[model samples]
Target: MARVALKGVRKDFGQTKVIHGVDLEVADGELVVIVGPSGCGKSTLLRMVAGLETVSAGEIAIDGRVVNQLEPKDRDIAMVFQNYALYPHMSVYDNMAYGLRNRGMAKDEIDRRVREAAKILELAALLERKPRQLSGGQRQRVAMGRAIVREPKAFLFDEPLSNLDAKLRVQMRVEIKKLQRQLGVTSLYVTHDQVEAMTLADRLVVMHAGIAEQIGTPLDLYARPASTFVGGFIGSPAMNFLPGHAENGTVEIGHGVSFALPGQAARGDVTVGIRPEHMTLNHGAGMATLPLKVDLLEPLGAETLVYGKLPDGLEVTARVHGETQVAIGSTLPFSVEPRHVHLFDKASGKRLP
Candidate 1:
């Protein structure tokens, strides 16, 4: 395993820049995920690292060696793509050994590697089956097995589980995590799915408009988002944002409701961010408590989601531990997690203390 670093990396397509001077570091044996919306340059960045696309500018180092101009093969990395990309006629064993054979390894050595990888992937029984004979998850494992046989320095996955069904995707996620840990391989996984990134990454790199919004452990990003975009993007059902002001050592949310600031702030407009899970129904008078009406309720067994609008007409969401019985048109009092509230500069959308 090796540490990978990107220094001032940028990519451009003519006059339009897709990636703008991004720097990242992946520690040895770490499993990092790069995630963002489609066309946000996440895939382009991965391609640059794979030598499939030029860097346009900057340096990329793997294992302390500059690989700016190195070939993909010379980079010593294996990539599993969204599609299985398997040879239809090749048996599972042959698929896994194809790379080793191409490198002119001895036949016995190829057999040993293929057999070992098949066992790890639990594909030994299906080794004789062709690509079409296996299920979607099985084919994806074959793709991973192909990468494992060569014992590359690192592994790269490009939405490898996107083709599987929802249930299968969850199962493969655990499998991939276990396989990576077992091999102790440094990995970079890219996907548009937030759930995949949250469940699989040791560190999650959230990207937006060609820039990395934030990078941290899954819980770190969730608890302390670097910006408003990150706070809203990292959680399920997303965080709710309300326009307000920060002045007089207090934050005024809406309809005359004000809460004392955790720290000093500038006297100007700001955005308040509170996650659905960080909100609670309140019946007592409390600072920052706002009068809200429940517009809808979604029962989720363990918890319930409330969709409603604040008095000032901004969308808001709240989740309760048990299935809430609040009805539409019912007035309810609610408050945010005191320390969990996030403030952002309304003009820049950047986080504020």
Candidate 2:
């Protein structure tokens, strides 16, 4: 396994620039995920690394060798695509062996690699099945198996799990993580799903509108987001952002609704953010409190999400365990854990302090 590096990578379509400039590094044998919304240049970046697309500027190196000008095959990387990209007429063994055969590898060597990959993926029993005969999850595994048999320098997955059902997606996610750990390959995964990025990545690279927002370990980025976009994108239900003022290390919303900032900051206008799970609906007196009017209630098995709005028209979401008989239009108190509150510069959308 080898490291993958991107130095000021850029891409453009005719006169329009899609990817500005991105600098990223995937350590040897590490699994890194490139995540963002649609058209954020994640797939474009991956294609550039795979040699499928030309780099408008800068360099892409795999295993310390510049591969920007190398052919896709010569780059020694295998890509698992969103659609599985398997041949409908070929059997599982045939699909996994096609690349090796093209390279003119010995027949016995090709058989050994294919059989080993099939065993690793638990597809040895289904090697005779065609693509149509296999389930979505199974077909996706075959695609991964095909990449595994190549023993390439690196692996690229372009939303490979997008076509599976939700339940199977969760299951296959675990399988992919396990396979990567066993193989210990340098991999770059591109996905729009934040959940997949969080659960599968050893580290995450958050992108927005082609720019890299932040790159760090999952916990580091989640705990200390470099920008408001990272805070809002990394967590589910999103972060609740309210525009307010910072006065003497505290943020003032309205009418005695003041929250202590995480650290010292100059007095100015700032956006206060707090996660739904970090805030609770409590009727106690402390710090800051907002009287909320419940609008909706979502019961998610182990927990319930209470959606409401404050008197100042600020929307709030609070997470509570078990089912609470909270009704709509009911005004109740809500408060956030002080340390859990996040402060950011309203103008730049960057974290403050």
Candidate 3:
């Protein structure tokens, strides 16, 4: 329903800078998720947009209005916190309607919004229950319902699903995605969970050490990371990095293992990146093969993860079919397509073309 923009936005606690200059534009109805590990300034960025933290520099605009000088309540945005911030003594209905009442909205209009949000969240039957009588998921829904009744210009979520158990987190993930799509409200979500970011975001901002490392679709970041840090952070099971030297159109990893480059690259020391899923058991013409000394196997129903070391003591991981049988201390051949290989500058860790 609104467009949110941050231009060179920054935050500093006295002389200690936490958020470096960050510029982002969230188009109306698009969900942009900021994902990174702890202490990466993700939550700080979200709080800046919500007016909970003062901007050290730069501008934040919501619906085309500058809000750096505005209070949180005047920004017309709703925030859902990690801890379900609901009054324990209030019924679910009253909790959802509290904001509207504070603004002196009509009693009937408040009732209409509350019931509508409850029905959409499937919390209609539990409206009369207090926060103490609800499950964690239900309490989260009540928090969301509270935000929904406000119908704010934008929605800000600060790891709203972090408190739930694994199974419940997945369920709530689905619900949150559906609700966002159904409402078409512009949303900015911050989470350390890459899986959640991949599933819920239209676009992802991969942050690290107060910088936005890469901003793109999930698959784009997976296939072409700009830096080794982005490469290691964006994917599950992570990409395997091998030290190698490149020259004359080839890279020699070590211990007689070398492969032809798919394209021209900087002819020097580089890190070769290969996703675990990109390696396979079968070799094809022009494919590079590595002899893996199997150290462990993790059978995950549909697939298994193979953890091993190369002849030079470089560790590697490969994902293979679940039924594939292998034993510890056994050596196996793993093949990698040259096109799937990623090359990064060893000194800088930036991707090399």
Return the top candidate by lDDT: 3
RMSD (Cα, Å) for all candidates, in order, is 1.4, 1.4, 1.0
Per-candidate TM vs. native?
0.97, 0.97, 0.98
Stronger candidate by lDDT (1 vs 2): 2
Worst 10 residues of 3 by lDDT: 257-266
Clash pairs (backbone) in predicted model 1: none
Q: What does candidate 3 score on TM?
A: 0.98
Candidate 2's TM-score: 0.97
lDDT of 1 by residue, 125-200 (tens): 9999999999999999999999999898888899999999999999999999999999999999999999999999
Model 3, residue 191: what's the lDDT?
98
Deviation (Å) of 340 in candidate 3:
1.0
What residue runs in model 3 are displaced by over 4 Å at the alpha carbon? none
Task: Summarize candidate 2's per-residue lDDT along 284-344 as a digit string, tens digits.
Answer: 4445887778999988978888889988888888887866677778987778767788888
Clash count per candidate: 0, 0, 0
Which should have the higher TM-score, number 1 or number 3? Answer: 3
